[model samples]
Target: MDTWRQIIADDEKSWVLFEHGTCVVLTTPGDDLAAQAVSVLRDSGPVHPGTPAADFGTVPLETTPGWVITSHHPDVLTYVSPEEIAQDGDNTPLAAGLYGRSKRDQDAHSLTVIHVEDNRR
Candidate 1:
């Protein structure tokens, strides 16, 4: 098993790429980033393990201060926050389990918790 350190290495800006080229770029060094990525994946849908790769879509990349995520697979659903959607307008149709109400509710709850925690810090 590759430790997070081994996967992240010494790069300040690193990404953990998935089998289908989905990736999470880490812009800071912290275990929290890994947890956040996993949370996002889990909240989105079922996360298959062991079948593909132990690290597939789960590993955290070394990052600095600002990190970004990118995915290439057509099956990958892009999530935009309500605030962002309001500001920029939703460009994609909500269908095929994308932007479903349940997922949105979960995301909203998670975002609220994160917002509270961040404010406390």
Candidate 2:
């Protein structure tokens, strides 16, 4: 089976499984990529199993610098600088449209923002 299929089958991680071929895995600020892959699945909310991946195409998370968003899907991820986030307002429309009043609403999807330490500084 494919890697994603295997992961889905295992169901042992914090995965925002969408209907399309896209999946967003969440991790704590201190968790490494490898660690997150195998870590026990935690409780996640606002799972939109019926929503298409295209709806999340523009949602951006405000995180610490150096935090990278990796994805196998072409053109599925983008880096949003702090300046851009600030200019967009306290709460971005894109995020509001998806997350709604509660960070994780039953009617919309939720995003988990992880802030990693900048070791270079």
Candidate 3:
């Protein structure tokens, strides 16, 4: 049910993320992050697998411009922005690094894995 559409920049062919029935341009990445943003937008966001027992962190799904990172994965966490934080109402967007329950300051949040197609060849 997550509908999507995109617009490429005239000069650079950059990606502009937009959803169906809305003009809220979520992001304008130079590459496929725009598609990932759309997928996350259609979904609940930060789609995560069950937490691992090792208490580790994983990479974050590259999110849209207005989305935030609230959970941690046990592999490769990434960076998010303030605008994304405010939009998602995430009080603590974890910085890209090691995360787990062992770390008193970081939450053991997890993220869903997303496969991005590399069209650059």
lDDT of 2 by residue, 1-121 (tens): 1334343343443443322222444433233542342222112223344544223333334334311222223222233334434545644545433332122232123223232121211
Winner on TM-score (1 vs 2): 1
| lDDT of each residue in 1-121, candidate 1, tens digit only | 1232243454454434332222244444255654554455444433334422111121123432211122222222223233433444552333212333334334323432221011111
All candidates: TM-score: 0.24, 0.22, 0.21
Residue 109 CA displacement from its true place in model 3, Å: 19
Once superposed on the true structure, which residue ranges of model 3 sit more than 4 Å away at CA? 1-48, 53-75, 94-121
lDDT digits (tens) for residues 1-121 of candidate 3: 0112212123332222222111112333435554454444333322344643323332333433322222232122223334434554553434322222222122212222233322333
Error of 3 at 89 (Å): 3.4
Candidate 1 vs candidate 3: the TM-score winner is 1
Q: Let me know the TM-score candidate 3 reaches against the reference structure.
A: 0.21
Q: What lDDT, from 0 to 1, does candidate 3 have?
A: 0.29
Candidate 1 is scored at a TM of 0.24
Model 1: runs farther than 4 Å from truth? 1-11, 32-36, 44-121
Better of 1 and 3 by lDDT: 1
